[model samples]
Target: MPETTRILLVEDHPLIRAGCRRLLAQRRNFDLQEADRGLAALELNKRHRPDILLLDLDLPDGNGLDLMPQLVADNAPVRIIILSMYGDSGRVSRALAKGAKGYVTKNDDPAAILTAIDKVLEGEVYLGQTVAQALALTQLQPETPGLAELGEREKAILDGLGDGKSLAEIAADLGVTYKTVANAAGLLKSKLRIRTSAALVKFAVERKSA
Candidate 1:
């Protein structure tokens, strides 16, 4: 007899939570708990120490991304699979970067949730089909300059920017002059066809994480 997999379902909607509960009921190897908010999820996580966390990205008290690090820390041996409504690559990348083992949107087949759980439990990273397809399409789409089109220096500059470093700081870290870093930033913005520094920064951050 296999040991039961303890699962904590952290979702804000009562109806959705109930539906998940009903679905999990068919799996004899799973023991499920529930939380409708981030704070409550944290409390239950600390108390129950579940083996797998099926988390929703939007919670009443806070965003699920904010809670992922804490839950991941508290449950080191456990797996976290994000069950969210958002399928955007940036969100998926951030959640995975923050230590989530899987990403699945609400729009995915219901069976995908179970599949994600199983894959993550086995230490694999799982992305829902829709999310994966969207990422693929986004990557294939034409642009002034995609991530793959960047040069080594530009890549390094973008990495530094992504880390929220100042231009001078990046220059110091890279052992280059401030002017050199600034020039690189300008080229990056031009090549990416982005109009503002804020957009460049956001792009770098999202791309680096992705």
Candidate 2:
């Protein structure tokens, strides 16, 4: 590790950013910076070359998941930890698959954030308690046929469906067009072996509650 563990915190919410700043302040060796948007994050990552990135999935300009590739392209020695409001298995899986070294939800005990930083710095992947349990449950459950083959976007759409969101609402939330979400939902029906949109929604709801 560098003499000072430089960290860039990317979050749009001011209170959350302040809380993170205070928490990280407990560590005498930490050097922290903040960014409220994806573009700013990329610029800061380029200039600061932080050792760790505490990123939020929701940003003002774009989805944090979509921004990961640009940050990774910086070729810095930064390890990313997602500090998200979402603790669902699909989001966690997608974050890790995108090269996040740690996954910590906002609802998790605040101390878990500090612990995640320590673990990632020590070269280990870290998952918050809730995230771990969610992933474990997802693995243990008998998934519907073809569910495992769904891509990240498909899984996200399914999650939105489970949350009782319409395709238009999901499109807005995901920063995509309504047609895109509709097409994905149609594809989801075929993949999950469901014949109708209403049946697909039922399956998603049941699976989410399971």
Candidate 3:
């Protein structure tokens, strides 16, 4: 039999962690361990050198999506599988762009979680279908930064919005298609919780001033 796979799970919710622990326990190949935050997970990495890390993007102290590069900065190599409540492409893409090995939405079938882990452990990049298609579109099309987390593209979008450019105008200026810009705006509206372009503009202006 293959050796037990040491797994490090980082999540803030106790009930969720307990459920995950139970699920992994049922899989004979895994040896489950748990932590509550990105910092704690990194510490455990230093001591345990786990084979796989099941990371939750949202945490009490910080975000796992932002922690991927740091997790890989050292000489040690660890596979990261992001588990998040967010099913949006922007959020999933952000995690993958930061070097995470896999991404799974909480709403996906439970088997998807296991599948993501297995794929990463086997050294394959994994993104759920919805996330994968989103990334594909992100690469093939032009998009606005409204829904994306704090990233370079997001900053550019904010700057443009703050400067009072319409999505069509911005898309034209940016050399991307109009629909892509519209989609990005839609994402931005949902992510930023703004119902109108005016609100988005206001939010951007305030954010820049702050």
Candidate 4:
């Protein structure tokens, strides 16, 4: 018989947490527990010692990274899979560096999450294809500013914009049409809530500093 894979699901969103539990419970071999915050997760970690950890990036009290070391100490055998909506390379890289065995975007199908859990359980690191590609690129170019929430195209355009280059020039350099660059810039403005190019540049600079 296969061993039961125990999972400790840590997420702040009630609906998401409940949905994930319901889905995971559908698997015959899973044993699951839930925690809504980082502190709660730590308490549960110390008590239940789950076989796997499904961690969210943002918690009410703190960033999930702060709990990773404690979790690793609590149960060295526990497999941690970071479940986040952001599929950016920087966050993926940081999570893996901090001991996450797997990183899968929430946009991934439920099966992807299940597969990641299974693979990590079998002692292999799992990174979705997009994340793996981004990580590979990050490795090849370490000096470039990596983003945790921005998409690849957005990161590239944003980087170009930071150099005070014209949108047309950036478009030409990227082989994308001018409207494509404009749309990308618009999307970034909306997501970042920056009204002016100056604000956008400022935000990018601050993120780089962080």
Candidate 5:
């Protein structure tokens, strides 16, 4: 960490940002900046070159996962800690694979955020309690056949299925054709090695519940 750690927090929710701002205020030698969207995050990151980035996975303009490569490339050696509501193994693993040094869920004890920042700054990876448990359970289970191979759209379709949405409804919500969603669902089944649509739906529900 530098003499004054420059931290950029990217989150759309004002209340959440304010809570984090208050929590982070307790730390000495910290300079904090905030951005609510991916575009603004990119701009601020370019200008400030923060030492640490507290990133939220969902942004109004784009998924934060999609923004990770650019941020990592632009800010070499800058540590990233993901602060998300999702504690699921899939999202956690994806975030880590994309270069996040730590994962902390919003529902975790606020201290977990500070702990993650400290640990990552010291060149250690940190997982909040809930995220650690989820990943441990995933490791213990029989791994899903091709879960890691699913692309963003496939994952989105699976999420839609988990929410009990029909294929047509998912297509409309995603602003894609119904056929597109149907094909993606078929691909999802193939990737997950599910024998039937009903089984796929069950898997999606189970994943969401996790």
Candidate 6:
């Protein structure tokens, strides 16, 4: 590890950013910079090439998940840890799959956040306890056949649902029309043999967490 650990903290909320700044101040070796928007975060990243990136999922301009892959690709060596209020398995899975070294919910203890930062910086994958428990709980449920049958797009729609995102939000994130996203949701429901939206959501949550 570098003597001075550079960290880029990307969060839109001033109070949350301030809290993180206070927590990060505990580490004298940390060189921290903050950005309120995704674009500004990227710009700051490109200029400083921070060793660690603490990103929030919901940004005013774009979802942080959408920017995660780009940031990871741009700064190949940087350790990215998602710090978000969204603790659903779908969001956690998506962030991890996109090359994030760690996922820490905003509700996690400040000490856990610091531990995550240290562990990820030391080349280990770190997941908050609640997130880890959610993933572990999936192991107790039997696998659903519908899980194996869903196509890529179907899975994407279901994942969005599991993450508690509305059809419009999912469409915006996927860069598709609202109608297209609605149609896809309908197709997934039909394929999964689910009659109600609640049932589909249950199945999606179960599958994603599993």
Q: Which candidate number maximizes TM-score? A: 6
Model 6 Cα shift for residue 63 (angstroms): 0.6
Question: In terms of TM-score, how similar is model 4 to the real structure?
Answer: 0.67
Question: Clashing residue pairs, candidate 6?
Answer: none
**Local error of candidate 3 at residue 140 (angstroms):** 8.0
Off by over 4 Å in 3: 133-210
Off by over 4 Å in 2: 149-191, 204-210
Looking at model 2, the pairs that clash are none
lDDT of candidate 5 over 1-210, digit per residue (tens): 668999999999999999999999998788999999999998888889999999999899999988999998888878899999999987887789998999999989999999999999999999999999998887798868898898888988998898799999999989999999999999888888898999999999898767
Better of 2 and 6 by TM-score: 6
> Cα lDDT of all candidates, in order?
0.86, 0.91, 0.76, 0.81, 0.92, 0.87
lDDT of 2 by residue, 1-210 (tens): 567999999999999999999999999999999999999999999999999999999887989999998899994578999999988887787799899999999989999999999999999999999899998988898868999899989988998999799999999989999999999999999988999999999998877655
Model 5 lDDT-worst window of ten: 136-145
| Candidate 3 TM-score, true structure as reference | 0.67
Q: What is the TM-score of each candidate against the true structure?
A: 0.71, 0.81, 0.67, 0.67, 0.80, 0.84
Worst 10 residues of 1 by lDDT: 138-147
- For all candidates, the clash counts are 0, 0, 2, 0, 0, 0
**Candidate 5: Cα lDDT at 166:** 95
131-161 in candidate 6: lDDT tens per residue?
Answer: 8987787666666657678788777788788
Worst 10 residues of 3 by lDDT: 141-150
Error (Å) of candidate 3 at residue 80 is 0.5
